[model samples]
Target: MMDWRTKLLDPTPHARRDYASLATPVYRGSTVLFDDQKAVTDDWRQADNGYSYGLYGTPTALELAARIAGIEDARETFIVPGGQAAIALIYLSYCPAGSHALVPYSAYGPNKAMAEGLMRGLNVEVESYDPLIGAGISDLIRDNTTLIWCESPGSVTMEIQDVPAIVKAAHAREVSVALDNTYAAGVMFDAFAQGVDVSMQALTKFVGGHSDLLLGSVSARDDVAYAKLGPIYQQLGLAVSPDDCSLALRGLQTLAVRLDALEKATLQVARWLAEQSLVDTVLHPALNTCPGHEIWSRDFSGSTSVFSFIFSETVTAEQVVEFINALTIFKIGMSWGGVNSLAVVYPELERPGVDFGGRIVRLNIGLENPDDLVNDLRQSLGSI
Candidate 1:
């Protein structure tokens, strides 16, 4: 008989029966068991072959990846540590040293930071263009230009891009176009249909609707894009926790209902703010006042939680802070896409020829009663 300690250490321990559940099991593992020596491998493409190592992903992570790919109609999807990691992976994969890339000035602040910091340090020139540059992007492309990034209804400033035009221009130059589809939750916008080569999302927001997890997805539009991203993904070891994947999976189930309710509530709040005396503009893409509202209407199927609004020039920056602080229902926070409302003032927010002067307030509407939220905003505006 085997020694008691040896038995305890047995890797082949078995349970009586596996529970048949509708939910995907949280597969926490690092080392995968192989049937034979020849079967041993360390491949990231588990969906195509078989599980090789946990550093790529366990079954839980792959399920999330597959589902995201299915929803986005992507050729394949890579689950990474966070949205920023996804961005980094894509950049490193596409932009070799001496290569040039284009990113919108209105992209997520961190993306621009990476372009200015890391990509610059690596000798890759990432140029910033107007989000609405459209087909005019052709004028910016050069022989070394390898990538173009589009972030629709861009971060905080909320400029919806002319993705189709940008894609057409980039393809004309044989350059790849990538999109930050986080605001669309990977579903509201058809990235593949719009000719995007890769689409990425911060699943932490809408997909992990409770704000309880941090995850991101990079979906390749075809075999070519997938082949380009896969090796770099493996090299970076972009492993995510199965537990976080589980939370994202749960978030996906309620995503539709959450998005619908958020749209209605957010529109109500945004429209009300538009009619107010102190408000200069509402930056929600659904509103005609937004910079690329027509493009948003044409390209996007829907909008999700977050958007921005600017206070009139008469309002002081300090007054904006006071108003934000006075809000009871809308909590002061940075990230959005959760069960609770969030508000923050971007005092130093900059665009080419525009200065918000800290008067730009971005809001992430939650699943709260619109009436209560409006009342909260009404009371806070009065405080200012």
Candidate 2:
């Protein structure tokens, strides 16, 4: 008879079993010892043999990377200190001096900043285009254009991009596409299957599921992009702490359960918000009223618990503050993908490039009962 536990623990032929009596073992160290002199010399080059040094990767990190790679159905995956670092590593690897990259206008705020600040400093040109540009992106691609970046159901405005159209446009121009998939995580969308060259996520969010660890992952289709990014990642000297990787691993075990609860509760809350008299618009891609609902429905399997809504003109700033302050369940905080519900008010529109205005509120639906959350919001709105 076969042991189920052994099979589960070592799913891959290359994976070695550790007898440690823990769900996931934490391995931490800076220097790794070799069994022999030739082994030491050969290990220095690493060259696909596992575990060269602690910083290169520990068993803890490799286990998490393997799990993520398995989920993405990709050849390889690498962990970074944070989500932004994962994005930066890709840029550093593929985009060289004088190269141009196109990014979605509504992409993550910090990602936009990276393209504007650091990418420019590296002599790379970063262009921000409308997420809905779709096939029109072909017009924007120049000879130097190296990459087209996309973020489905953009972070702030939550607009679902026509990914296939954009991918076709970019491919015609011989450009690679990178998507910041933090919002949908891997549960809702398959980036590789959607023709994305690179898929990245801030594991700190839904993957961590506890709002505790800071981690990020980048998955690539073939060895080309993965090989290109690997050295840069190692050279950058970025590594997730063993403890954080272990936490993310634990979070992955329950990701299916957490995301299911969040999806159900978030939709309920979004629908209620849509009907509220004090709401002018709800910017959830999962809702049919959103701008790119058709595209979202077409490309994505599910939506995350995060979304935004705009208050009606009659709702004043004072009232908004009153509503947020009066909430008993939704905590006012930034960052999401946790078991607890959170609420935050953002400038109605993004600044400098795009503006949705200042009347918008972002919500992260948690594991709380949908009825209780609705009641809290109703009471808070009544106070306003």
Cα lDDT tens digits for candidate 2, 245-264:
99999999999999989999
Give the distance in Å from residue 328's predicted Cα in candidate 1 to where it truly belongs: 0.8
Residues 1-384, candidate 1: write the lDDT tens digits: 889999888977498556798899999999999999999988878889899999999999999999999999999999999999999999999999999999999999999999999999999999999988899999999999999999998999899899999999999989999999999999899999989999999998999999789999999999999999999999999989999999999999999999999999999989999999999999999999999999989988888889999999999999999999999999999998899999999989888998788899999999999999999999999997
List the candidates' TM-scores in order: 0.99, 0.92
Query: What lDDT score belongs to each candidate, Candidate 1 first?
Result: 0.94, 0.85
Model 1 shows how many backbone clashes? 2
Clash pairs, candidate 2, are: 348-356, 348-357, 348-358, 349-355, 349-356, 349-357
Worst 10 residues of 1 by lDDT: 10-19
